[model samples]
Target: MDQYAQLLAALTEAGALGEEWRGAFERAPRSAFVPDGIWVEDSDAPSGYRLLSKAVDPVGWWAEVDSGRQVVTQLDDGRTDGPGVATSSGSMPSLVASMLRHLDATDGSTVLDIGTGTGWTAALLCRRLGDGAVTTVEVDPAVAAAAGVRLAELGLEPHRVVGDGLLGHPAGGPYDRIHSTAAVQRVPLPWIEQTRPGGVIVTPWGTPYANAGLLRLEVGERGRQSHGRFVGDVSFMWMRAQRPHAVTAPDRPPDHRGPSPLDPDLAEENVHAAFAIGLRVPGVRTLHTWQAADPSGTHRFRLSDDAGSWASVRFHDWDGADAVHQSGPRRLWDEVVAARRAWLEDGRPELTRFGLTVTATGDQHLWLDDPGNALS
Candidate 1:
């Protein structure tokens, strides 16, 4: 079997691809959407990625395209040459399939596809729902142009626009579904407005602390409100405007030094703990660092609000309690500990148990179990 067929078979066996999307997947092969040169993770490389060109190494390039892995298509938004960081990528096939399934689109359903990275998703939507029913928006002009070319080559012409996906394409109003390829800290109000009542919005939503959760929200009457639970865990590139600020340690000495009530490792090890803590504590980002040269195997868990408050917990190999340090007005570690405590008191509910409600006034209320029980 060809690589694409094998990929489809594998996805079918893994239950990632259902019969509804099998035809679309076959029609829009990933190879056609992937760029000629793609970046792969490299530990020894300065930027942690090494580019593999289709011309130079077809074998390696094809392998990456066929594999169920995200392929970085652009670095630094195509601004710089070396020591690159991925600004855009073709998402993993399984993840794409899963997100599409959550979309719950059907024949005659109008879809607004946000973040047209490679246009593969738009093509699939067009194949399933027809070209006129799908509208795709991308913020980057170059990216959009390239993706448009690919879509046109495949004779899949969805309404393509270049604009901030956060605002969404208002011209295509009252869509049956709004699907976003990018992750967001805040669901854009415009999206809710553009979606018709009872419409579904599927996107990767998360906080700065734990940026990974697939959220599916259903719009209410008059498109004034939407409510949904986190259906699964998914990590996607953040919408440009919603990307978190870089976390850095404060220059001055810590204002308070004490022992931590909870093991700092738990927050990093358990995704549910991290997600719950993130929901409770807003604007906090986490960084886990280990001293590779240190023979003692000591590591540090750092937290920062990026508003002058920062905290750190040092974990040592010895059995003594980990030392916690905090500086600035907010005791970041204390807040995290409190959040963790609340999560535990609530029986450590899994991330899926958490849900979000958004009002027309743009208030986002996160809750546990039901909308009446608000957490934030």
Candidate 2:
């Protein structure tokens, strides 16, 4: 069997590709959406990614396209010279299929697809829902134009839009289903507003602690609020606008702070603990830098946000005390420790046990087990 056939067969066998979307997947091949010159993320390389071209290596390129891996089509928002941060790509087939399966859009239902990357998702939706039933919006103009061309070539015409994905395309309004291909910090108010009452909105939800969780919300009759549990773990690129603004730690003074109450090793070993920590600590991004030269296996966990707040915790080992440094209005490292303590006190809840409630006014209340008990 060909690569596409093999992938489809595998996905079907794995139950990732539902029967509802099986014919659409076969009819609209993923290859049509992927560009010739694409980049794949490789940690082995110093630059983090290596470019692959259909012209240079058709066999390899074809293999990647048909494979389940994500194919990066753009880097650094189209500014980088080589192998920079991946800005966009054709998402993994299994992930796409699984999300679509979760979407569970029925016939005659009008759907809105956010982040039309490669337009593959839109194409599949068009094949399933028919022309004019699907509307897709992309943030980047160049990406939108490229996807439009590909969709046109495939004879699929979904209302292609070029604008912020967070702000759902209201022109396509009152959609029965709203699906975002990108990850978001919170459920956008515009999505809830644009979705019809009782409609479904599915998106990859990320917290400050970690880039994970697939949120499946059912729009209420009023369309002003929605609540849903995280269906599964998902890691997708942030919505372009929701992406973190440029923030870096400035030079710190030669002052020593108290040791962090939280254990870095505990957070590192437990994904759920880390995720819970992130949920409690809002607007901060965490990064850990390992010390290669240090014989004691030391590492520094840096926390910073767009608000000019920054903190760093350096630890030589899990058992010993770690040095903490802060040089901002907000004591981020302290906040993380407090949150971690709270999480531990709460018995270290799993990601599935958590839920989110979004108001039309943009208030996102993260709750534990029940919406009534909001996490503070």
Candidate 3:
């Protein structure tokens, strides 16, 4: 089989791509959407990414494009000589297919595609539902223009808009389906307003502590409210506006020091526990690291709010109890311990069992099992 066909077959076997989206995937090959210059992760590189040019290394470029991994298209929001943080990427093919499948769009379904990225997603939507049925919005003008060019190359022209996706392009709505490639801390009210009543909105929703959950919300009658569950796990670039502020350690020494009541590793190692804790504890970021010079082989787990609060726990090989240090107004370590206790008391539910409800006014309530059982 050809490379594209092989990919399709693999995705089909993996259950990421369904037969319904096969034609669309076939029509819009990922290679056509990928740029000539892309960044790949490198451990030794100072900025953690090494740029590869198609002109200089066509074979390597093709390999990366064809691979299952996401292709980083822009770094530091298009800053050439800036720190190599990946700001935009062509999402992993399996993830793209899986999200499209969950979208469950049908013939004549009008879609508002948020975060155009490489335009590959818009192309796929256009192929499935026709060009007129797709309207894609991108925050970055340069990214939008480049994606538009790629879409044109594929003979696909979805109404392209250059603006913040949070304020969705209302002119294209009330759309039947709203799909966002970017992750959001909270579902935008504009998205809810633009989607027709009974329509669906599929996007990655998560907290600052853990950014992994594919949320699928079904709009309520009259478009006043929506309810949905985290159908799957997905990690996507945060919507530029909603991206969490950098988590920096407080300059001063820690104020409180004691033995941790709970193992810090539990919060870092368990995904469900992490998700649950993130829901209960707001505005906290978790980090795990080890001291290179520590002779005792200590593992450090740190928590920060990017405000003035910070916490650190050190786990040594011979530990009676891990040492905990907290500073600032918020006792982050204590909050995490309490959140984890709550999760366990609630029967340690998986992330998928949790769901979200949002009203027209953007009041969000997270619940367990049913919408009525709202989390405090």
Candidate 4:
């Protein structure tokens, strides 16, 4: 076996790729998909990889691999430049295996792969489950075509489609598994619809400022649902179709005082939950959170177009729950108070204990634990 090939086996045995899916890891050549001139950043060394000027520089290109290093294959902002934007990449082998471990892909199982960047993952699915059983889609038509050709070059032929993955590829319906490489603020209904009743759909979902944690959910019949904890924190671009819907934060700084609205102290205690709740509310999109570290006094604002309102919510946790100031239309501070009251009355639950149930056709429903209560 080649040197990198041996390293792949080692990583798999070590549990990075899981023992079950090691077959896929063995056949795929990481070097084949990595262009010769691609820039790589190796923080382990004093400097990054020198820019490769050729595609077929056979010397040392097949060296062994390591883990947890962020490789910047594409630069100059991926939007404008097509060649190096990291439009396609061999994902960190460990992460690939981690998710695959959750998926537990089996022979003959069909998979709908969201975000077929570079077609490396599609190739993995083809290797494990057979090429015809894997259907991959990329919103970028150009990227999809290039990935298809690359996979073909590897002697694999999987169905590659160019369309909004949020809608999924209907032609490849009733898949046994569905995997998305991107993060989403809201889970799309089509994904639930496309998956087999018990099939799994995994993606990252969380606040816009921080990386989204992985959410693995199973679809139930009649729009009923059951899902558990989110996995490790990871970041990825949002899906194209779901871009229109985003969570926009309130404009006020994280801390501030406005005497006229509501109790400030309570607002301060529940401020974070309020912001997370807004994303679940209808008509809310494009959120930006700005917090004031100042303990003295500063009015925190939650601004957004969905509510068509701008308001300040202020409070100090140490001072008291009653110390509040509200200045805005529709009592924005009061709304935060409502969310807090709801949490308190129900025994202030943390995020991990929370469960999400997506039943709506156009929107998703987030419920707490086994109950049917709606969460933003």
Candidate 5:
């Protein structure tokens, strides 16, 4: 408890968290959700796995959770002798704070929490929304059962179900808010249909290649229609159904440097745009990197097609991930060029300038601030 107090204090100072939510943080000690074995990200530590023994440095463990990165508590389907791959975990406390803020959870509202890993977030929701008003779903039976016990320890008993979150819990219908701790590229139609009109559904939406943003959507009169814009950049693992068997090699590597100073702007790849491109260009992989040989003034990129053919590009620019390059036969670079051209033609509007508008008829529209500018 003392260890988490320190963590809470740090969060409170940062203004990333609130004193009001301190009870939720105290009520759910992160140590409760972490397994006995895990890994530490320090340099050159052979046994990456961490243990929960009083003799061990418990303070250090709590500190790691303070960083906003996901911690792997369980790996490789929850079976590992030592340092097994962390397949599941209690997400970082700061990340949880970000999600909760994005949710804007009001008091006494019925909320459905998907991906109840470690049950830490569920308890937090229970604190904000009250018990039974929060229902969480986990795909793994073990995860769901374990979280159920931890919630009980906190004197909370939110409904914890083990099943596919893709098919949201219909039994807990007409929820005021739906929050998914995990990321989903596709906003399942069922979620839109389940929530009450004007209810909010927040999830990290991305494509198989790169879609990264906390998507905030609002359901309307028609249970099936939703419209919203992305807020802030975020990353998450692909849903089981949204993952790729293997990403194709780049047709040719890309040049991190752009054609001109202007290209540098687009070099910062929009995760949503990246994902949308992946869906349109099915089976194309895009990668950007710097020239390791001479780090000073060289850039490279690679994009490959599913057929195993790849393309490479070279240019001079300083943006690492956002750098652009041209490669391969398919001219994936040209595709990026085309999108930018279209965006510019539309008055160089930023993506947020046009938010997503979903309709009950399954019609998805990207609305620009100037409604007249939308290409349709």
Candidate 6:
């Protein structure tokens, strides 16, 4: 079988691609949306990825497009000419399908798609909901224009505009459904404002502690507040405006305190552990690095906040003591331990058990099982 057919068959069998969206997948070929020149990540490479070009190798280009892997179309918001780091691209087919499935948009539903990217998601929505029913907003002008051209070539034209997705395209709404292709630290107020009462908003929501999940919120009748549970785990690039402000790593002075009584490896890399920690310790980001000082290359997790506060936990030996150091007003490690203790008390709840509530005034409250019992 051909690559396209094989992909369709595999997705259908695996249940990632449902019949509801199969028509869009068939009508709008993925190859049509991909750029001729793109970057493909290589795990072993120091630079992390090598650029692929249709001009250089057509066969290899088609292979990667059909391989169902994310092709980086632009880097550093199109400022970096080469493959420095991926800023945006056409998302993998399976993940796109999965998110669409969860979105549950249907005929007659007016939709607003955030972060147009390659415009594939908007095209898919347009195919399903019709042209006038879909409106897509992209932040990068160059990316939006390129996507608009491709979409027009396919006879698909949804309201493709260039603007900050965080502000949302208010002219499009109050839409019946709002879907964002990017991840957010917090749900924006405009989205809630533009969505009709009882409408749904779907996007990948992340925490500073190091976990992200799909958030599906239903705007209340008043349209000021929305509450919903986390559907599942999802990883997406952050919205440009909401992206964390870069802060310098805090120094580990020689006069730092003793080793932590807690084992860093105990809950170091676990997703649920990170999620739990994020609820209690807000406004902190983690970066895991492998120190060469330890031959085993055990990870050293660094915690930092926008306030220049930072801490590091080096797991050199799994069976022995791990080094812990902090130089901040807020004791981040202590917060992590306390959060973990709370998680243990709550029977070690997974991310699925947690939910979020966004007030009309825009305060997000993280809850476990019951919305009334919100975490600070």
Candidates by lDDT, descending order: 1, 3, 2, 6, 5, 4
Model 4 stretches with alpha carbons more than 4 Å out: 1-14, 37-67, 70-78, 81-90, 209-211, 222-229, 244-352, 360-362, 371-376
Per-residue alpha-carbon lDDT of candidate 6 for residues 1-376, written as tens digits (9 for 90 to 100): 8797789889999999999899999888788888999888878765587778999998999898888787788777776455366789888888888888878888899999999999899999988889999999998988999899999999998987899899988877889999999989999988999988988999988876754788888888774568888887777888988876554566656235456656776555477777777778888887777658763565776777878577777666433443777776777776787888888889888888889999988889989887898875
Position 17, candidate 4: lDDT: 70
In candidate 3 the C-alpha lDDT for residue 1 amounts to 76
Mind giving the per-residue lDDT tens digits that candidate 5 earns over 1-376?
A: 4556776788889987876677888777677776555565544555445444324766666665544557666655566454444557777777677778777777778898988888888888888778879989998888788788877877998887888988889998878889987777567877888788988888876644455667788888874557787765666655556554454444444543344333433634554445334434445555655568875455555555556445444555533444444544455655555655555566554444545666786565555664344444
How accurate locally, in lDDT, is each candidate? 0.90, 0.84, 0.89, 0.60, 0.67, 0.82
Model 1 lDDT, residue 270, Cα = 81
When superposed on Cα atoms, how far off is each prediction in RMSD? 1.7, 2.2, 1.7, 6.9, 5.3, 2.3
Candidate 5 ranges with C-alpha deviation above 4 Å:
1-15, 18-20, 42-59, 66-69, 76-86, 250-266, 269-284, 288-300, 304-310, 315-330, 340-354, 361-363, 367-376
lDDT string, candidate 2, 1-376, tens digits: 9988999999999989988999999999999999999987778876688888999999989988988888888888887565387889898889889888888899999999999989999999999999789999998999999999999998999998899888888877999999999999978888888888888899999876688888888887673668888888788988987886544545666244667666666654576787888898888887777668973565777778768678877766443443777767788877888888889899988888888988868788889899998998
**Regions of model 3 farther than 4 Å from truth:** 295-298, 317-322
lDDT of 4 at 136: 91
Q: Residues 199-303, candidate 1, lDDT per residue (tens digit)?
A: 999999999999878999998877367899899988898899999988875789988887877777777658898899999889999887767798346588888
TM-score for each model? 0.96, 0.93, 0.96, 0.67, 0.76, 0.92
lDDT of 6 at 329: 79
Give the 10-residue window scoring lowest on summed lDDT in candidate 6: 314-323
Q: Model 1, which residues run further than 4 Å from truth?
A: 81-83, 290-292, 295-298, 317-322
lDDT, residue 314, model 2: 72
Clash totals for all models, in order?
0, 1, 0, 29, 32, 1
